[model samples]
Target: MLRVRQWLFAASFFVCGASLASTACPNFFVNGSNPSIDASLTTRTTEVCHTEYVLLASGVTKGPLYSAQHITAAQVAGADSISRTGSFHQETAIPAADRSQTSDYTNSGFDRGHMTPAGDESTIDSEKESFSMANIVPQDHKLNTGEWAKIEAKVRDLATNLGEVYVVTGPAFDPDNTPTIGKDQVAVPQYTWKAVYEPGKGAAAYLCQNDDSITCDVVSLNDIKTLSGVDPFPALSSSDHANPISLPLP
Candidate 1:
């Protein structure tokens, strides 16, 4: 059954309150710039700004081409309720023709992988907004349930230790045109990449295969920019860029 994941962690810092005070989420979308990179294939794309995260959606791909968000341990804590907030739903903000339908993943042997995970949102609205199809990608079920999930948890752990974090995650479509799923021809990404930045500390990037092998590696942000042309946060200081981070998932 598809259900929300539970999180348990100890606060190294003082728990000032039961939840994070409502504050503005950080803008990680390169100064509110459009997130589209591959314009040739992305004929109809839109930027769907949710409460906590922003998604660059592609109608051609039937899914989000990219997503960005601010993550914090306290925010995760506040959102991790015993009950799930929302089920999967089509995004009405975009035209129906420009959105992926719930039926797209049905019996497709793939999972509706969330770029900005529902668990990362601190409020019901944000959590519910996460279910919009514009923020989903067709990913291998094994990877979704395995290493990717582990990596997300580890990110939360890092946020807990570091205070706050910014992340940009998206699919890496094949150069030879990715495979399709469902009748809508939703593109199945061959690989996925996640860019992470923590204020005052350092930044790291991770690339992982979308298969069941659980093979993922850290790379340089410039490498990602060169390969994928995705410069998630342009305003970030250059000094914060760190060498390849080796964070092995348990």
Candidate 2:
């Protein structure tokens, strides 16, 4: 029954997009990329410890991969979720290769929290894909499912306001590669994110490493800044990653 309702929601969203094809795609990015922008094509898959993470095509696993969509869906800031998953850029995460091996579970017990979330998706299929195990990981219950999810929801609203722009999100690495787990059920790392937004640009980005949450981890927003002054969408530069300042709105 729940599955049927979800599919119905997804189908309706698809119809709405097709119905509103005349709407324009907006773009927003204040200023420009900082001089130190890494330009490493942050859009592609990146590793979050145990292994660099990337979106893989259905039924295909291993090696280099990218999400199903070249673009990511972003929402605007608001008290509630504005544009949910129907935007459809969100993708699922893959499971660890081996749990027995610490290195295999390199992200041992780490949750594969999404840069973009399924609940934030605008359509049902988009949301369904989010449920795929490929896009999951052991997460710190607190961060992955709580506040962090809130930020993901805001990104969707931000995108709704801006129109269209590039987005690239993943985890914030601790040069040392350390992932912290929650009370045997959640994972909490240095940070989780929904980075990227041009205020007026409909585009935004998100990134987060998995932790140890039995369910999805929920980290609240502390309003972290994007000190890099460059877009992590195309690629985050070493300098930008190193210089994260304050979030634009906060």
Candidate 3:
């Protein structure tokens, strides 16, 4: 029954390129429009573009508000041919005061989670760039290695099967009592989310709490906007924002 509804939505929906202004790395986004963060979330931000992805790094959070990527089946195949470097470093492109240091996550009891997974990068340069701290957040070790890992793999599989997909990933902090870590005071998000747009098909997001409990859900894009204060896909039609296509979960 759910599959029927999803197929119907896919059959009827058509996504057109948005005419919004382009970012420094416009190709990474669905319609060249970078994800916009609400002023209340954080006022200071820098746009950092990498070889394979682009992100909005927040000075207040000392991490990425969101990272965007355009993935293709051929890219996934190439990424699979490479080896994991596990090389993590601070992004020199971001202002020193606003960026997180490797030391900030050291002994802080959190993993430096990548908004765009290393496995998604096809070249050695891109894989290394994936390690930049600007694309990272202080995430729970258990959640990062467990369910979140599964989610990343699932998206990669989707790219392999769907030919192409646009992805935006980021964190959501609690307004009143956000936690901080290390000397830089890097903010720890309460929840992390990954939104996927299968062009001409449908869109949906996987949202999970950054905790040992590993709670997660498949939600509408509007739900993500309401919770995170960022509309990841501003170009998608209102109906697409309101409706969530079913996604296979691990």
Candidate 4:
């Protein structure tokens, strides 16, 4: 997640708090500006922002990543998918090709995936916006559209059930050559599945799918792996777990 205050938001900060806050959330982010908070989890370099559902890929430091749309330094056509606050970012090589130049997309056979996926966003606009060069990772198309997408959907439901969710996601590698995006048409994640949570009732949850292709058991497991916490201030060291976030007043 990210945080920022544009000229349009200049007066809102003082009316409320010093700065907006957000954390590594459970859902995919699009047109991502800046959440009020930052995240605590850390991976290597660039891939940091490519974390599961959050972006902390600051080249200079290791901390919660503001939306590339929020920071001025992070701007490029399709580099970031959104321009709302301007913090959207992606790491696209100008050539958009691998050394082979055949099509890094198919040559490797690993799908160019989004750490913070697009379909995982609430609106198509947001999804389209987050579809940037920075958020892509080499993933198995099956995993992305299959379980990975389910996991992301679960993250979104978590935000809905718990008011706001701070999510962080990325490849599960201990370390490896951060995957590159070859000159292949960017793949959009398929929303074949979904997850729902009713925290107001308790810690109950459920997962559903649009297609009869994936399994329910595995989807829940992956969702748990990526998002298993109740942190109100996820931006503060990722250790600040509060009561499950509360949903917006109904």
lDDT of 3 by residue, 1-250 (tens): 2432343244222322222334888898777777765655446777888888988888999999899999999989999999998688888898888988889888989999999999899999899999999999999999999999999999999999999999999997766578999899999998899999999988999988888888878988877776677778887889999999887787
Report the number of the highest-lDDT candidate: 3
lDDT (tens digit, per residue) of candidate 2 on 1-250:
2432333334332221101001011121123221112223223323221111123221212211122222234322221343343322222232333111122224454545454356544444445444433344344566666656665555455446555333334333232343443222222333344445343323333433333332222121111222111223333333443433333321
For candidate 1, the clash count comes to 0
Task: Give candidate 1's error at residue 18 in angstroms.
Answer: 42
lDDT of 2: 0.34
Give the better candidate number (1 or 4) by lDDT.
Answer: 1
Candidate 3 lands at a TM-score of 0.90
Instruction: State model 1's lDDT.
Output: 0.69
Off by over 4 Å in 2: 1-112, 175-190, 199-231, 235-250
TM-score of model 2 relative to the true fold? 0.41
What is the per-residue lDDT of model 4 for residues 45-101, given as tens digits with 9 covering 90 to 100?
232232223444433221122222121112122223443332334444222231112
lDDT of each: 0.69, 0.34, 0.84, 0.34
Question: Is 1 or 3 the stronger prediction by lDDT?
Answer: 3
Which residue pairs in candidate 1 collide?
none
TM-score to true structure, per model: 0.81, 0.41, 0.90, 0.39
Regions more than 4 Å wrong, model 4: 1-103, 176-250
Ranking by lDDT: 3, 1, 4, 2
Encode model 1's per-residue lDDT on 161-205: one tens digit a residue: 877788888876655557888777888886777888766656777
